[model samples]
Target chain A: DAGVTQSPTHLIKTRGQQVTLRCSPISGHKSVSWYQQVLGQGPQFIFQYYEKEERGRGNFPDRFSARQFPNYSSELNVNALLLGDSALYLCASSLRHRGETQYFGPGTRLLVL
Target chain B: DQQVKQNSPSLSVQEGRISILNCDYTNSMFDYFLWYKKYPAEGPTFLISISSIKDKNEDGRFTVFLNKSAKHLSLHIVPSQPGDSAVYFCAAPDTSGTYKYIFGTGTRLKVLA
Candidate 1:
C-alpha cells in the first residue's frame, strides 16, 4: 500500500564528484523510471526499467546511468556531476513499462556546488 | 525544441471558480497524455489522463480534454480549492519505442481563498 520510496531526501555534492540515488518501487509494481526537475521547470525523463531490463533512456549524457534490481528497486548513478546537474531526482513506478499511470516518490534533491 | 509547452507560466483563480490549464504538444505520434500536480520540494503526483482515442476523461472534480487536431490538451478543475494550488504539468510518452515521457514546462496555479 505504500507508494514509491526514494532515499537521501536531500544531497549535496561537489562538482566532478559521483553520486548514487536509490528508489524502491511500490508493492506489486514492476516498472521504475527516473526523472530530473530543475528549478521552475517540469520533470524530464531520465531512464525507465521494466523487469530488470532497460526499457527506455532519456537524452541525458553517458555520465548518467541506472539499473534495476530483481526486487524492482532502482539506482540512478551520476558521475562527474556538474552545477547543471543540480536538480530534483524523482523516481516513479508503474504496473508495467508500457503506457500506464506512473506513481512518484518524494524525490531526492541533489545540489551540486 | 520543446515538444511540449505550457505557455502560461502561472494562473490565479478564486476559490470555487473554474481553473483551466492548457498544454500544447508538437509530436503527433504521442497517443497517451497525462497530467501531474506538484508542490514545492515534492515529486509530481498523477492527476488525470486521456488517451488519443478519447476526447475527455474525468475524475471527480478534475477533467482532461484532448484535441488531437490541434495537438492541444487542457485540464479543468471545477470549484477550485485553495488546496489545489500547485504546479501542473502535462506529459506524453515518447513515440520512439522508449516509453519515456516528454513533459511541459508546467503552469503554476494559485487558488485564492
Candidate 2:
C-alpha cells in the first residue's frame, strides 16, 4: 500500500505571508497528526485530527491551525509567518488500534525568507 | 521546557559493532514510547516501540529498553551497518488521550565501515 503523501515537497514563503501545506493519509488510516521540525531539532507536535475532528493541539501559537477532510486528508495553515517558521512540516497517520504505530509522509519543507 | 532529551548530538561507531542511543524523559505521565529513524530529505519512519508496562521490546536487530523508575529509555542496534547511518528520534505519547507526541532533539549516528 502507498504510504502517507504530502504536497508541495518544497515551498518558499516570505515573512507576514500565509502558507498552507497538505497531507493525504494512507488509504485505510483514520488518525492524522502534524508536526514541525526545525533544522537540527526534533519535530514538535502541531495538531492532530481524528474522524475529521480536532482531537488535540500542541503549544503552537494562534497563527497555526489545521483541519482534516472527510477523505482523511489534512491541511496545515500558518498565518503571518515569521522567519522562524521555516521548517519541515510532516504529516503522520495511524490506526486507532491500541499500541498502533504512526506512519509519516515525506513532508513539505517550507522556507520563510 | 524540553520534556525529552538526547544529550548526544552525534555518535560514531564501527560497522558490525553495537550502537546504543540513549533518551531521557522527564514526564512520568508518558506511557507509550516510540523510536523513529530518519534520513535527509525524508520523514521519520517507525523503528520500534515499548510500552510503559514492558521493560523491553525486541524486533530483529532492534531492541528498545524502558526503565520507568529512571524515566529513561534506550535503543540498541546490533551489528550496525553503514546503512544505519541516520538520525534517531525518541518520542512519547500523552497519557491524557490526546495522542500527542513529544520528541527528542534526535541523535545522528554514523556507522563507519
Candidate 3:
C-alpha cells in the first residue's frame, strides 16, 4: 500500500497571504496529524484528527487550523503567513489516536516572502 | 520550552561502527517514545518505539534504550551504513487525550563509507 501522501509539494506565498496543504492518509488508517518542520529542526505538532473529529492541537497560534474528512484525509490551513512559516509541513497518519506508530508524507514546502 | 532535545546537531561515524544518537525529554507525563528517520525532501519514517514499561527495545540492527530516571533516550545502530545517514528525530506523545507528539530538534547523522 502507498504511504501517506501530501499535495502541492511546493508552495510560495506572501507575508500576508494564506495557504492550504492537503494530506491523504494511508489506506485503512483512521487518524491524521499535522506538523511543521523548520530547517535544522524536528517537526512541531500542529493538529491531530481522529475519526473526523478534532482530537488534539499543538502549541501553534490560532492562525493555524486543520480538519479531517470522512475519508481520513486532512488539510492544514495557515493564515497571515509569516517568514517563519517557511518550512516543510508534514502530515502523519496512524491506525488509532493513541500510542500507535505514525507514518508521514513527503510534506508541503511553504515559503513566505 | 523544548521538552525534547537532541543536543548533538550532527554526528559522523565509520560505516562499520556503531552510531549512537541521544535525546532528553523533560515532561514526566510523556509515556511513549519513538524514533524516526528522514531523508532530504521526504517525510520522516518510523524507526522504533518503546513504552514507559520497557527499558529497551531492539529491531534488526537498531536498538533504543530508555532511562526513565534521567528522562533520557538513545538510538543505537549497529554496523552503521551510508544509507542510515539522515536526520533522526525523537518524539513522545501527549499525556492528555491529544495523542499528539512532541519532537526533538533532530540530529543529522552522516555515516561514512
Residues forming the 10-long window of minimal summed lDDT in candidate 1 chain A:
A36-45
Accuracy of chain B in candidate 2 (TM-score) = 0.97
Model 3's CAPRI class? high
Off by over 4 Å in 1: none
Question: DockQ, per-model, please?
Answer: 0.81, 0.67, 0.86
- Full candidate order by lDDT, most accurate first: 1, 3, 2
| Candidate maximizing DockQ | 3
DockQ of prediction 1: 0.81
Compute the lDDT for candidate 2.
0.93
CA displacement after TM-score superposition, residue B13 of candidate 2 (Å)? 0.1
Candidate ordering by DockQ (highest first):
3, 1, 2
Q: Write the per-residue lDDT of candidate 3 for residues B1-113, one digit (tens) a residue.
A: 99999999999999989999999999988889999999999999999999999999999999999999999999999989999999999999878668788899999999999
**Candidate 3: clashing pairs of residues:** none
Please write out the lDDT profile of model 3 over residues A5-83, one tens digit for every residue.
9999999999999999999999999999999999988898889999999988888999999999989999999999999
Which residue runs of candidate 3 sit more than 4 Å off their true CA positions?
Answer: none
CA lDDT of each prediction against the hidden true structure: 0.95, 0.93, 0.94
